[model samples]
Target: MKKLAVVNGKIIDVEKGSILQKNLFIEDGKIVEVSEKEPDNSWEILDASDCYVAPGIFDMHVHLRDPGYEYKEDINTGLRAAVEGGVTRVAAMPNTNPVNDNISVTEYMIEKAEALFLAELYPIAAITMGQKGETLTEMGLLAEAGAVGFSDDGLPVENAEVMRRALEYASLFDKPIIAHEEDKNLSGDGVINEGRISTLMGLPGIPSTAEEAMIARDVLLAGYTGGKLHICHVSTKGSVEIIRWAKKRGIPVTAEAAIHHLTLTEEDLYKAGYNTNFKMNPPLRTEEDIDALYKGLADGTIDAIVTDHAPHSKSDKEVEFDKAPFGIIGLQTLLPLSLRLWKENILTLPELFKKLAYNPARILNIPGGSIKVGEPAYITVFNMEKYTFTEGMILSKSKNSPFIGWKLEGKKKFIIVKDKVL
Candidate 1:
C-alpha cells in the first residue's frame, strides 16, 4: 500500500491516555510513524483540521440480522451504517435464522463479511444451542471457527445449571460468556421499565430486579468457576452494584452499558409521546439508573459502551406502544450519543475513548483499537460540533432510531480501515 498521512488533527490515544496534535503516516495498512512535522511531498495527505482523530470505534454488541431478517438489516447495509458512525469493527450477535451455534453458520457469516470488506466483523456464537437455554452449543468448535466470544444475546440463559456448565466449558478456551441478564419470570409480559412511567402509562413493567437478580447469579457463577463473564447492556443501578462487588472480590467479570441507557431515561418515553422507537430490552431506565450507569463508566466499573444496535422495519415499530418490538437502530447515532458523555463532564475525551475503543477491544481480545506504531491503520476523524440528526441521514436498512430529528453534538468526517478510506 502507498504511504498516506493524516495531518493537522488532535490525535487521542486511549492506550496512552493522552491527546496530542500530530500527524500519522501509514504504509502497508499499518501506522509506520507519528511526527510533529509533516513528511515531504511523497506522501498522500488526508487533512483532518478542526477534528479529533482517534482509534477506530469498536462496538462489541450489534445485531446484523443476516441470513434471516435481511429486510431489517444485512451484512452490507449494517456494515455501511457502522462506517457512517465511525465504527471500523463490530461483534455480530448469534441470534439469526439458524442461530450461529454450529461451525457452518459461523463460516457463512465470516465469508460473507469478508466479501463486504467495509468493516471488520467478529461473530459471537450462541452459548446455548438454538438459544433455548436448554443445551449448550459446541463452544470449542465454534471458537476454533473464529468466534471471538459466546452469547445468546437476545435471550438470557435462564437455567442456572445450564449457565454454570456453559461458563465452565467456555473457561477452558479463555472466552467470555456474555450474559443478557434478565429473569423472564420477573420481566413477565412487561413491555417497559417497571417504575413511575409504566404505572402512568398503564403498561406492564419489567422491574430492575429482573436484571439485577440475573447479574448477581452470573457474578457468583463467574467467581465459582473462574470463567470470564461479560455482562451485556447493563441498565440498572443494582446491577452495577453487584458487578462492582464482584470486581472488588477479584472475580473475572466485565460489564457494558448501552449508549441509550446512559443517555436516555424512562421519562423520554413520556416526552416523546410514548414513541415505540424508545422501547428496548432492559428498557430505558430511570434517572437514578442512568446516573449510576454514568458513574460506573466514570469509575471503570462499566468496561465499555455498546450500541446494542437492534434494528426493525418501520412496519414493526409503527404499531401501538405495547405491540411494537423492543429495540432501536443505533449504529449511526453511537458516536453522537456517546459524545454526550464528554459534553456532560461525565468522562474526559481520552477516558471516553478508552471505553469506546480500547476497552471493548481488550474484552473481546481483537485487533484494531490502537494508534501506536506498527498497529493496523484503523482510525476515525470527527468534528465535535452541533448538528441535527435526521432519518434521511440514516444509512442502515432500518430507520428505527429515536434521535431522528434531535440536535446532537459531534459528527464523523472520515473512517479508515486497514489503510482503505471509507
Candidate 2:
C-alpha cells in the first residue's frame, strides 16, 4: 500500500465554511483519514505548514488547443500549466482544428491526458457538427466516449430552434449545453466593447446586448425544456440581471465569469492603447459590468469562476488589434488573479474555493471539490506569498497575457493529484 500524509495545513471545509488544522492521510490515491494524528514512520510525509489546503481547482472552461493547435498549446503543455496554476482537473472546450465533434477526438484527448498523468482532462464535445450551429452532433455517443458536457464555445448557436432543440436533446444525457452567448448580427466585425472607448479608438464594438440577448433566449429555452444550461464568460451587467431573473423563475441554469471579465474592463484596453492581449471574445465590458458580476457572485447568481484560458501563439497575437485572435493565455495566472477576490473580502476563503474548486466540479459532474475520507486525494497547498507575474513564470506554450507584469499573491507550494505530488 502506498501511503502519504499531508501535515500541518489549514484544511478548508467548503461545506461548513470553516478551516481546520488537520493532517490528511492517503493510501493508494484515496484519502484514508483527516485528523491531527501523526502518521507512522512507514507513511511518507508532505508538509503543508502555514499553507491552506483545499481541493484541487477544477477549471471547467479552458481551451487546451491540442490535436491541432499544438503550436499554441498541446495537452501536455496545457496540463502542465494547469498543475502549475493549482488546477487538478480541467474541462477542455471543443474548438480544435477539426473540432471535437466526434467520438474519436473525444477519446484521443482523454487517452492523451491519462498517459501524461498530470491534471485530469475532461473533454467538452461540440454541440453542432463542425460547430456550424446547424445540425447537432451525436452527443450521446460522444458522452459515452467520455465527453463530460457539450458546447459550441468559440461560437454561438445562431438559430433559436436549433438552440432549443439542443437544450432539449442535451437534457436526455443529463449534460449541460455550455452556451457561448453572442449574437453575430449584433457583434459584426466588432473588436471591443461597444461604448465610449470603441468610438474614440475608431474601432467597431461588440455591444453588451449581443451577449445579453442570447443569454436571455437560452435561459428561457432551458426553462421551457428543463435542460441543464451553463453560460460561458458572462461579461455584462444586463447578462447578470437576466441570469438572476432566470434563476428566480427557476430556470435550470448556471453561469461563470472569467477572471479577466471579473477584473479588467474596456477602460484597461483603452489605457493600453489598443493592445491585442486585452482583446477577447465578449470583449471586456465597462466597470459597471464588473460590479454587477461581483454582486452576482455574492448573491449566487454566478455559479463559478473560470479562466477561459485561451492561448494564442506569439505570431498569432502579433498583429493589429482588430486582426488578432480573441483571447489571452491565463492558466499560469488563474490562482493569483482569483486570490484577489478573497483578499479583498469580496468572498470569504471557502466562498472563493466554492467558485474555484467546488462549483466547477458540481457543474461538470466531476469527482472532486472537497477533502474528506474515502475521497480521491486531489489537493492544492498554497501560501499567500506575494510575487510579480512575469513571462518567466508562464509555463504555457504561448506567452500572450495582459497580466505579465502585474504583482500578485497566493503561490502554490505543492499540488497532490491522486498519489502523485507536483
For lDDT, the strongest prediction is 2
Tens-digit lDDT string for candidate 1 (306-382): 89999899999999988999999898889989988998899988888888888888888776688899988888899
Candidate 2 TM-score, true structure as reference:
0.98
Cα-based TM-score, every candidate:
0.98, 0.98
User: What lDDT, from 0 to 1, does candidate 1 have?
Assistant: 0.91
Q: Evaluate all candidate structures by whole-model CA lDDT and list the values in order.
A: 0.91, 0.92
Show where candidate 1 strays beyond 4 Å: none
Candidate 2's C-alpha runs over 4 A off are none
Sliding window of 10 residues with minimal summed lDDT for model 1 = 361-370
